[model samples]
Target: MRLSELSRRSGVATATVKFYLREGLLPPGRRITATQAEYDERHLRRLRLVRALIQVGGVSVASAREVLAALDDDSLDQNERLGTAVCALPHGKPADADDPAMETARRRAEQLLELLDWGYDPATGATIPAYGMLVTAIAALERLGYPCTVADLEPYARTLGRLAVNDLDLVERYGGTADEQVEAAVALTVLYEPVLLALRRLAEAEESRRRFGRK
Candidate 1:
């Protein structure tokens, strides 16, 4: 496919695609002429993954680029590469833990770690990425003086865990190979949380209204 077709098919703009190419996040296409390049389906797939991580997953361009590099590297297993990318982000920005404003932030990291342990699935045994993201979020919260607690996040973890189970079941229903399943799982782990969190909030509001016998 041509660059325009790749952009249209990937649902990303041509300029953004070029930016990705220049950043080395996406691989170079085969040059058919001095000004024309041909991309393949792998490029499309990679673009979709990159878009999901950045636009949906709320990752920075640099962090997303790191993840793309890890994913593109053929030497590691898919899960290991995914884990490396997840771990590579500057999620744990240091702060003055002794500062009153940072106390909550410090505790929040601890609580997030506890939540990761709490939410661990024995079957898949995948917990690192969630831990990485949660720690990062908590660190940001600390900077804002809004350190979260395990008690504060328990309801969220439970709600999100159930939704994750549903998503996992849907992925497994397709009945593909283990690698495909792992790939889908990695995609879901990275991509689904934002959408699920938004929908869950809506559901919680509706449920709260029903319980209160209000419209």
Candidate 2:
């Protein structure tokens, strides 16, 4: 396909496609002439993934590039490749536990993980990428006098564990290549967070209406 055709098929502007090529987000097309380049479905797929990472996932260009690098790395196995990309995403930056509350929060996070027998990639430590953020958030809650006990969090943890299994099931069943798996994982993780939050808020509204009739 020509540049224009690729642009048309992808619904991304030609200039934007060119920008992605220049940024190395999309691979260079085969040069057919001094000015003409040929592209194909592979380019289209990559272009869409890049767009999803930046536009939909709200990742910075640098972070998206890092994820793309992970997808292209052939040395790592499929799981490692996916993990590298996921870890590269700019999720909540974990703050250093410098204060007493933060230190206490870290302890609580460790306890929750232990109670659930959860671990990060090391398979023994409560050191997932978002673990620090979890600790920081819990510290804030405690400081605000709204601390959640481990018992209060266990139900959510159990429910989300099931969700994780379902999420991975979708990726493994439909995600084709290693690159495709990474893309699927990133896309699903980024996209569905808002879905989860919206559902929670909507459920809260419903529960409130049931408990105390809406004004």
* Candidate 2: segments with Cα more than 4 A from true spot: 121-128
What does candidate 1's lDDT look like per residue over 1-215, in tens digits?
99999999988999999999998878899999999999997788778877877777677888877766766567888667756765644443433335554455445656554566754443443245445456556556656767566677777777776877897798798567654554456567667666667887998998988898645
State each model's CA lDDT, in order.
0.70, 0.83
TM-score of each: 0.66, 0.89
Q: TM-score for model 2? A: 0.89
Which stretches in model 1 have alpha-carbon errors above 4 Å? 88-165, 169-186, 213-215
lDDT of 2 at 13: 98
Among residues 3 or more apart in sequence or in different chains, the pairs in candidate 2 whose N, CA or C atoms overlap within 3 Å are: none
Tens-digit lDDT track of model 2 for 1-215: 99999999999999999999999999899999999999998898888888888887789989989988988889988788887788777767677558888877877887888888875433534455667668878888888899888887789889999999999898889858766777788778877887899999999999999999957
